[model samples]
Target: MKIIVIGATGRVGAQVVTKLASDKENEVFAGARTPENVPNASNVKAFKIDLHDTKDTILSELPDADALIFTAGSGGKDLLQVDLNGAVKVMIEAAKKGIDRFVMLSSRDSLTPDSFSGPNPSPLANYLIAKHFADLWLIKATNFDYTILQPTALTEKPGSGKVTLGSYSSNENSISNVAAVLAAIVQDDSTIGKIIEMSDGDMAVDDALKNLI
Candidate 1:
């Protein structure tokens, strides 16, 4: 699988890239603003994907990729630019290139955007507005086999391989754990068209994902 990881330089995105590249059968294209930071390995190559650039520019930089995994975000800086439009831009370009498989690293807030809906929702509105639209765009507009992983508040801990991969809720999830999920699902056709709400639990990662089918 030739996987293109957007926001490959960010916290979770970087980890996702590493995990994907660890598998010898998978060729990973780590797309980031700072491509130099991405390691130059035999299976992994750093490519340029600047969301700040025009949609055409971003599209042109993309290779003949098999799958495109979007883990990018603006981290509260430019939500519209990077988080919302940037993601949508990549999706459009990926479709233009005939890349069908896509996995998105979304937030749990996006699951209940109406409960936390509107431009500035209350209680659980951390990037809610942006995530809502971006996630919706993928579901409604694209033809890709998409799986959206919506995780709750994140923790800094290194989570276990076991996890609950369903309609479960918890305080926090490890970033690494989320990245692991991303890596697994991108290659999993069973995860297609599923909007999984994930959290930490006792089920093994592969087992948990398998149970979802």
Candidate 2:
């Protein structure tokens, strides 16, 4: 399958690219704002994608792909630009391109802003607001299959190869587990059009996906 991964330089995006590229049957088109940060792989082709112009960027790179994986987002002041507006742009372009399936990497509760942590989540958490808006828009948009994976706080520890998949968000997921789940979903046909929330648990990734479906 031909798949395009946005934010290929990011923590979870990078790991997904690595796994996809290692598989001979999969072709990975990895995009990052900085080309140098995108990892090298025999099957992965890296390119620079400006989040500010996500529609054009994706239109230029994704026509040939069967799926698009959206992991791109900004945390600082640019979060609104890159996460909310940029995300909607990408999804819109994907619909125009007739892309078969699209996957989004989102934060836990991003779709339900009222459930956000703290009476005053930092301004930085505005990123979550943007993500929530994007997710809501996608839920209401037309064309193309979609999957939204909402995971809790990300960590850098090596993956435990375990996770819990459900419809509700929680604070228990690890970055490692999230990455593993993303990679698994990229290859799993059953997860299309589903919104899966992930958290750390003793269940294997395959088992998690199974239970999720």
Candidate 3:
């Protein structure tokens, strides 16, 4: 499988690239503004892509890609431009190019009911809102096989290689575990058109995903 990973320089994105590239059967194109900075791997190829770039420019850079994983964010700046518009634009281009699968890294808060209406709403509400719209666009507007992973607050701790799908209470997930999930789901047909909420738990990543409804 040939996969394009946008925002490959970010924390979780970098891990996703590493996990996927380690598989001998997969070819990974790590897309970042500074392609030179992406991790070095035999199966990983770094490519330049600015989320803020024009649609045509971004489309031209993606070639022969079978799947796309979107993990890009503007880090609290320009939420509308980069998080919402930029994400949707890439989805549009990928659909145009006939990419079959698209996996989006989203936040749990974006879908939770009380996160937006409570007296003390999430400080990152704006960012979550952007993700909500972008996720909606992928579900309603695009034709690709899409899976949205909505993980709770992310931590950088080493992965336990164990996770829970659909729901969890701790509301915390390791970046490594998230990467493991991304790598696993890309090759699994059961995840198509499914929106899963994830967090660290006892079930193995593969088993958790296989049990998804």
List the candidates' TM-scores in order. 0.94, 0.89, 0.96
With candidate 2 superimposed using the best TM-score fit, by how many Å does residue 64's alpha carbon deviate from the native?
Answer: 1.6
For model 3, residues 1-213, the per-residue Cα lDDT tens digits are: 999999999988999999998988999999999999998899999999997889999889876789999988888888999899999989988888999899999989676647766798788888888998899899999888999999988998889999999887567899999999988888888999989899999999988987887
lDDT of each: 0.88, 0.79, 0.90
TM-score of 1: 0.94
Q: Residue pairs in steric clash, candidate 3? A: none
In each prediction, how many residue pairs overlap at the backbone (N, C-alpha, C within less than 3 A)? 1, 0, 0
- List the candidate 2 regions with Cα displacement exceeding 4 Å: 116-125, 167-172
How much is 8 displaced in model 2, in angstroms?
0.4
**lDDT by residue (tens digit), candidate 2, 2-89:** 8989889987888888877878898888988886888798888887778787576667865468888988867555877888888888
Error of 3 at 204 (Å): 0.9
Stretches off by above 4 angstroms in model 1 are 118-120, 123-126
On TM-score, the leading prediction is 3
The model with the greatest lDDT is 3
Off by over 4 Å in 3: 112-114
